[model samples]
Target: MKVYEALAAAFVEEGTTDVFGMMGDANMFWMNALAQRGVRQYEVRHEGSGLGMADGWARAAGRPGVVTTTSGPGVSQLATSMLVASRARTPLVAFCGETAWGDQTAAQYLDQGRFAAAIECGFVHLSRGDLAEEVVQKAFYLARTESRPIMLSAPMDIQQHEYEDNGPYVPSTQLIDRPRLLPDPSRIERARDIVAASKHVVIIAGRGARGSDAGEQILRLQKRTGAMLATTLQAKNWLYGDTDYHVGISGLFGSRVAMELLQEADCVIAVGASLNSYTTEHGYLFPEAKYIQIDTAPNLVMGNGAVADCYIQADANTGLAELTASLERESVTIEGFHTQEVRRRLTAPLIDPSEFRSQPDLLDPREAIVVLDAELPPELDLVLGSGHQTDFGTMLFQRSREITSNYGMFGAIGQAPLITIGSIVASGRPAFVVEGDASFLMHLSEFETAVRYGIPILVVVMNDQALGAEYHKSRAKGLDVDLAVIPTPELGRVAQSLGGDGATVRTTDELRAALAEYVRQPRPTVIDVRITRDVLSVPYRRLWFGEDV
Candidate 1:
């Protein structure tokens, strides 16, 4: 067997079912080998799309996803998406094809190590054909354990060389998936004391809390302590149902009600959350609250954001379970948090579309979202791309278990198109992506990939003819916003030209008709819904002015 064949064997050994990539001559051999071994290949239009797909797959599958790209430009294109994945704590293995061994003068040859390091991603080069399998296994190990992206550089010349297998293939999980850490007794006792003293408490859960029974345990802790439940944007649907106590996502895109309730809490027990600046709103949201943070790996902090006064270093689920058990020793500290008044306040529409004046030519984005929120099927997985439109859609829509957004780590926008593709492939279910025009246009090629593969992804473009967030912010700041605006094109007709279904919607009735048709014959359909720039999100209004309307 050759080196590429051994790499394929390693992937199969580790049980990677789906491989996403933009194959070039350099990586084609290994890609073919993987395909030959019955691994489903999601051939993307661009290199970054492949990584984006892997990130989405990792998010959906709860395991490491794979992407293979050629060297130089292929690896360079992965930087932004890789950073997003890193911020998202996604486990991804990107096996990139490098220049031939000792071919430093090649045009496409790049210092892949430097590239990976610049983006803070793990990279390992397969220098020896005999140890190719070792590097592959190690890449998977780092990807899984570190919960970040790892790149395995396979030199084209070395990839064709005979693989000198020293022994049988051992799956990387056997070495990596050992027993994890549990919460310390002293720390649990300390956290309990903190909660015991507090009259008002709040639990802010993050991606770390999404694993195991952490969500269930956190809710239990909340019930015992009468604490409010809030989640970072990354962990929005960890506890899905809408309730007064269940404060929605807290961040730059946080609902007004969530931040208001969060401000009143005395002790905020952040479980499995990073307690980053975004979630905390730079400590403005809970500036005076006593923060008792719990995580598996609470390291030495450099910034004021992650700096917690009482740090409980343990697994989120385990720590939460232990801390809840300890807190259960005592009765509820306080009550009346989930009062009827609070429930009414929480349930009130964040942005009442009726209040906002309607537009004549274009549809109000809020109104369109409201209609979509009602019309969209419950089963279709929903994804939101980043922008002001996202702020509207994310807050407006009823979150299901099958929801994802670019509102994760880096807030990267363009990857949603590709991420939606991967998500559609993984679940074998129809999905929809509501994205801004600028964001959708960034990776427009991926839409073509969806069309080519017959992926049932409904692409909803909120065409405001500008970057909605920046446009609103620039105007508020009294800056010239000419550069923020773009020439709005007929994206719906473009989708049609590419052999996909499409409709250009301006009114609620038009949108309803398009949605009705889409539900009946779901395909790669583009609903280019033009939204007026006159309307803005409630968060935007609050951020710009001192008003929370």
Candidate 2:
């Protein structure tokens, strides 16, 4: 067997069924070999989009995503997506081809290891055909354990060499050990004491709380301690409808009432959350709250630069379950944060009632989001894009399931559409990618990839005819907003030209009709909802104009 074929067999042994990437000379042989072994291949328009798709697949499917790229420029194209995946801590294994061995004069000859290191991604070089399976297994092991992207670089020349048959290949799963660490007895007692003593307490959960039964434990703890529930932007709607005391998302996208309640917290128990600057509002969200963090890596100082008073070093599930048990043993049930008045405030509408002046042929983004939220099927996975429009979707749109992902971690736009494609494939369901016009145009060519693959992804473009954030920020500064405004092409027509359905809507009724048509037909569609640029999102208004929501 050739080295490339051996690598393909190793990938299959690791149970990698779905792979995403564009084809190139260096890696085409291995990619073809993998395809021949029944692995699904998703060809993307760009290597960056392929990496984004892999990241999305990892998040949605709860497994390490796989992608392949050729040498040189193909590997360079992964810089941004790799950094984003590293920052988001998404597990992904990328099979990147290096230049031919002993051929520095080759066109694609570049130091792939330095590039991977610059992006903070783990790199493993496959130097020997005999060690191919071991290298592939190590790549998977690192990705699974570190929860970060790992690139396995195989040289083009080496890939063409014959490989010695190494008996049966062992998958990384056998070597990987992930144990749920229980919290220490002394630390649990300390956390329990803090919870019992505080008057108003808030429990903020993050992505780590997902898939661990931590949400249920958190709710049980809430009942025992009368703590209000909130989630970070990544974990939005996690605790929704589970309790009357739950206050939606907490952070820059937090509602006015949620922010107010968070500010009033006398103690905060963060479970599997990083307590980052945005989530804590730059250390001002919980001014008087004693911070207690529970996670595998407990830190003395939080990501917001505040000192944690207590840290329980354990997994979210084991730690929270033990904390709840400890509190229950002491019969600690406080009743201050979950009052009837608080319940009313928690369930109240998040959107501002004040109206913006009506435009001639545009819908208010906020109102349009609420309409779309109501009209779209609840089963469709939602992928939110970054920019000024994200806050509107984050605050207004509600989902019945926890199948929501976003491309805002690195504050990068244009990834949501591609990410939505991977999510749709992973979940085997329809998905809606709520993105701004500027963001949508970034990877608009990928819509053709969706159409070719028959992926059911609906791209809902908030057509504001400009970079909404830059335009609003320039307007706030009394500068020339014209510089930020870019006259975009008709996005609906663009999608239709790419072999997908398209609809341009100017009213809420039109938006509803477009969504209904998508649900009925179930194909790749783009709904260009022209929203007015006159009104600013609540979060943007608060940040730029200091307007209280």
Candidate 1 per-residue lDDT over residues 1-549, each given as its tens digit? 999999998998888999988888789999889889999888887788889998888888888999989878888888898898887778899999999987999988999998999987998899989988899889999998888899899899999999877888888888965566877788778778888888778888877777655767777777788788877776765676734477677766677777777888778888767777777777788867788888777453412445676788887778888888787776535673757787688768777656755588698888888888789877888888887888888777755555776875586778787788888887888889999999998988888888888999999999999988899999999998887899877899999998899999988999999999999989999999988888878778877976776
- How far off is residue 287 in model 2, in Å? 1.5
Which prediction has the highest TM-score against the true structure?
2
Cα lDDT tens digits, model 2, 158-220, are 999899996988899999787768788998899889888999989998887865658788988
The alpha-carbon deviation from the true structure for residue 115 of candidate 2, after best TM-score superposition, in angstroms, is 1.2
Angstrom error of the Cα, residue 490, model 1: value is 2.0
RMSD to the true structure for each prediction, in A, is 2.2, 1.4
Off by over 4 Å in 1: 242-244, 300-306
Q: What TM-score quantifies how close candidate 1 is to the native fold?
A: 0.94
After best superposition, candidate 2 residue 65: deviation in angstroms?
0.8
